[model samples]
Target: MRLRRLFLLLLCGLRAEIQEQDVRAMVGSDVRLGCTYPEGGSFDLNDLFVYWQIPVPGKPNTNSVVTYHLPENSSAGHSDSHYRDRAWLSPDRMRQGDFSLQLRNVTPQDEQKFNCLVFRKSLELKKILEVVVTLHVAANYSMPVVSGPSQDEELTFTCKSVNGYPRPNVYWINKTDNSLLDEALQNSTVSLNARGLYDVVSVLRVRRSPSVNVGCCIENVLLHQNLTSGQPEMFAGDKRSVTDGPAHDTLEAGNKPVFSVLGVLVVAVAVAAGWLCRHRCPHRSHAELV
Candidate 1:
């Protein structure tokens, strides 16, 4: 009866060893999938083996990710062709019940369900631990760049962001009132780049106003990141000149006319001086000759 009870307890322990974990990692970064064997406190190093695999597309059997035994010394392990040197298990960590898999330079394809099984090589390789890990990878979108308040009938502007993962939400805002613009006034496009990242562009059109303050925003929901292109303020019909005040709002619109006036004054002074010298000097010379 005691032997039967111990066998049942071991079975229960094995069942309890299976754990499910979710991990999020950024693209081109290294991440560790947790597969710790907490109850495995007294195991022989020479008799231990660990295997990590991901599900194959069409096969019922899981595809190998990495395998570990001896000679790793916490550094190396045999990995599948797809994983190659980018995935490995540490022998030194395994002895301490840390059989986690380290994946390097994570890509979009690395996002998958992984299975880790640890076995003790006694009579016939007995399974001692198991873990399932789901990896979620994310990449933040680039900062938004807004261009133009070009006028044809309505003022038009374009905003773009590149190399983001999944999709992103775009927003156009009126900075003067800090209010969201009408969605019907804007058009957006999203495309996958060569690296499988998202590229987005949005064009917004608004009616011409006396003073326009507009901004663009992009949000990556997966990464919990938000980027904004600051509001640009332009005056359409303000007649204030720079000479009116130093801090007037007309600096942009008033500087060009100021430059033109200075150019005209320079040409007028040159012509006046030339005409006076030409007419007066010839008359004085002719009088001296006479």
Candidate 2:
């Protein structure tokens, strides 16, 4: 009978935790880390204690996110400097057994495993629950910008995007036929910036031809989205082709006509309006806007 009583006491003293969970958050957004307790309630505020912490690699001490001693509801004195004003808990929700955390403006650096521990006081503080939450962070890349051959250059185009998370794929498309250009004819590179974001650059070269229309695409697998920008339909041949290149340049410049043609059209419109005004209003003086 004494052995059975000892077994009961051991079992009663041992506590178990729920399985770990995963959460996905986007960069520059807010997220809630879920945690709860059956008895982290207001019934006995003096007995409840909640703590949120993150384990740092190669460090003996963990980083404190927030700590609440139910009796006082005070933040941990030694909270990590990086998380200051960004991580917080709600006292009103704690009154209803909710000890979740609210994290604001989550960045790529915020990706980590968080530990939530709850303690109940009796003769002393006794751990009652532990929850682990893993956070995965992601961000969308900016729209691609494409630059093509200059007036005196060959048919080389560049496409670039910035402020993306993770590396992304790059492709060159012949917008004339909607077909992807050969990968061998393109060079692509991706690099990480100081802010932990990615920047992508790609260059594509096309053969000398009479006309060419090309597009550059950036594919972010993490965000499952793509951005594309097409060239303004530039020329592809030698100096002799330069004679006709300005036509394409004109089209790219918002379909602006040549100066001579624009001047002639303006003169014709002014003459027509003057004639109409003199004939319609016979008593008016013979004066035109031109």
Per-model tally of clashing residue pairs: 0, 0
Candidate 2: tens digits of C-alpha lDDT, residues 76-151: 3225777778888777676677778788999888788887766665635456667788988888777566665654
lDDT for every model?
0.66, 0.63
Best-performing candidate as measured by TM-score? 1
On residues 18-128, what C-alpha lDDT tens digit does candidate 1 reach at each position? 789999999899999998887757556777656687877788753654555532234455656778878887666777888899889988778889888776657355677
Cα lDDT of model 1 overall?
0.66
lDDT at position 153, candidate 1: 66
Once superposed on the true structure, which residue ranges of model 2 sit more than 4 Å away at CA?
1-15, 38-43, 58-73, 76-78, 150-154, 176-179, 235-290
Worst ten in a row by lDDT for model 1: 281-290
Clashes by residue pair, model 1: none
Candidates' RMSD to native:
20.3, 16.4
